[model samples]
Target chain A: EDQVTQSPEALRLQEGESSSLNCSYTVSGLRGLFWYRQDPGKGPEFLFTLYSAGEEKEKERLKATITKKESFLHITAPKPEDSATYLCAVQKNTGFQKLVFGTGTRLLVSP
Target chain B: EAGVVQSPRYKIIEKKQPVAFWCNPISGHNTLYWYRQNLGQGPELLIRYENEEAVDDSQLPKDRFSAERLKGVDSTLKIQPAELGDSAVYLCASSFGRGSYEQYFGPGTRLTVT
Candidate 1:
């Protein structure tokens, strides 16, 4: 069965602290990996999509990278506003919208 | 363009009561999806539609849950006699079938069943 696991279920950091969240997966084949940021009571906001290993994307203070067995969402100099649960999902080439998701990592940045 | 839209941001009800949620995807998006998210968990796909057709519903609980996407645009999800375990956020998302890897999400409907 396809599976996704994220480490550091919860992380607390002071403002300006940098950290990285990990998402490891085991699937039959890799098509794409997605990253999202979800605030409390709101749906997830799209962050990054990594199609293959060694690929990276950035937005503001967040950087996402993907590899064969895992993906990482790295936050640089994060602020309190950057705090939220980060989600990772994997979609295969089977031509379906089904995405296997990891539980997610809750991040809290305090000033 | 407007993003995905969902109605009833929050709903609180007792067990064995019927509840419904609505969604409107971005114009021109051919794919629509419904997901269930528990607190602290990632959203899980409950159903998916491809131009008014339900392409995936393997995870949906057919015993009490049903969904429809009329005209391939707006959609609705219904739960009959909702159970306490049904308390979760219902999220609606849409993506262009033109191979767009990104899916836009709406503010979810948070359901609390007592």
Candidate 2:
């Protein structure tokens, strides 16, 4: 079965603190890995998509990197505005484009 | 361009009642998806539509859940005789095409069943 697991269910960081969230997956074949940010009472906002190992993408203070077994979302100098639940999902190469998501990591950046 | 739009931001109802959520995908997007997100969990895909055809609905509970994407644009997801376990946020997403990797999401409709 394909499964995604995110580590550190919750993380509280001070403003400007840098950290990384981990998402490990076990799947038969991986087509893509996605990262999203979700605020309270809101749907997830697309962040990045990593297609292969050693792939990296960035937007503002966020950077995402992927490997064969896991992916990481690294936040640099995070602000309170960046606080939200970070979700990681994987798309399999099984013809269909269904995404299997992880439980997500709740990130809180306090000033 | 406007993002995916969902109506009725919140709904509270007693168990066994019927409920429906609406979604309008981004303009020109040919792929639409409906997802259910429980508290403390990630969104799970319930159904997916390509144009006006439902190509994927393996996860949808057909016994009580139904969805339609008429005219290949806006869509609706209906739950009949809703159960307490059905209380969750219904999120709608859209991608440019079938092979697109990035999907834009809507605000979602939060449902609470007592």
Candidate 3:
């Protein structure tokens, strides 16, 4: 069975604080790992996609790194606007378009 | 280019009632998806469409849920005799192609069953 688990269900960080959210997965064959940011009353916005172990991607103050069994979303110098629920998902190599998502990590960055 | 669009941002209804949600995927996108998201949880895939054909719907509850992508451009998800547990946000997303493509999501429709 393929499953995704995200750690630290909720985190409260002061402005400019740095932290990392974790996503552990168990899949038949790893195809792709995705990161998204969702705000209240809105949909999730696409962040990054990591395909292989040791792969990393960055956008603005956010960076995402992946390993064989897990992934990490590192927030550097986060701002109030960076507060949102971060979701991590994985797609299997079976050519199916469906994505298995984690429970997500709620992040609140206060000024 | 406009992102995925969904109608009726919020809806409230009684149990056993029928309701429908609409989605217009991004122009030229060949793949569309419908997902249900409960509060405090991530979105779960209900159905996925490739062009006008439904390629994956194993997670959809066929007894009460049905979906259609008429022209492969827009789609609709309907729930007949909705239940109290069906209250959740219905999200629509689209991707240009199949494997490994990034998906863009809509604002989502929040459904509340009383």
The top-ranked prediction according to lDDT is 2
Q: Which stretches of candidate 1 lie over 4 Å from their true place?
A: none
- Candidate 1 structure quality by residue, lDDT tens digits, B1-114: 787899999999999999999999998999999999988788899998889899889999999999998899999999998999999999999999846778899998999999
Off by over 4 Å in 3: none
Q: Ten-residue segment with the worst summed lDDT in candidate 1 chain A?
A: A91-100
For A33-99, candidate 2 gives per-residue lDDT tens digits of 9999999999999999999999999999999999999999999999999999999999998867799
Which residue pairs clash in candidate 1?
none
lDDT of each: 0.92, 0.96, 0.94
DockQ (C-alpha based) per candidate is 0.87, 0.91, 0.88
Residue A34 shift from truth in candidate 1, angstroms: 0.3
Total clashes, candidate 2?
A: 0
Tens digit per residue, CA lDDT, model 3, A38-111 = 99999999999999999999999999999999999999999999999999999888857578999999999999
- Give the best candidate by DockQ: 2
Query: Least accurate stretch of 10 residues (summed lDDT) in model 2 chain B?
Result: B95-104
**Candidate 3: true contacts recovered, fraction:** 0.84
Clashing pairs in 2: none
Docking quality class, candidate 3: high
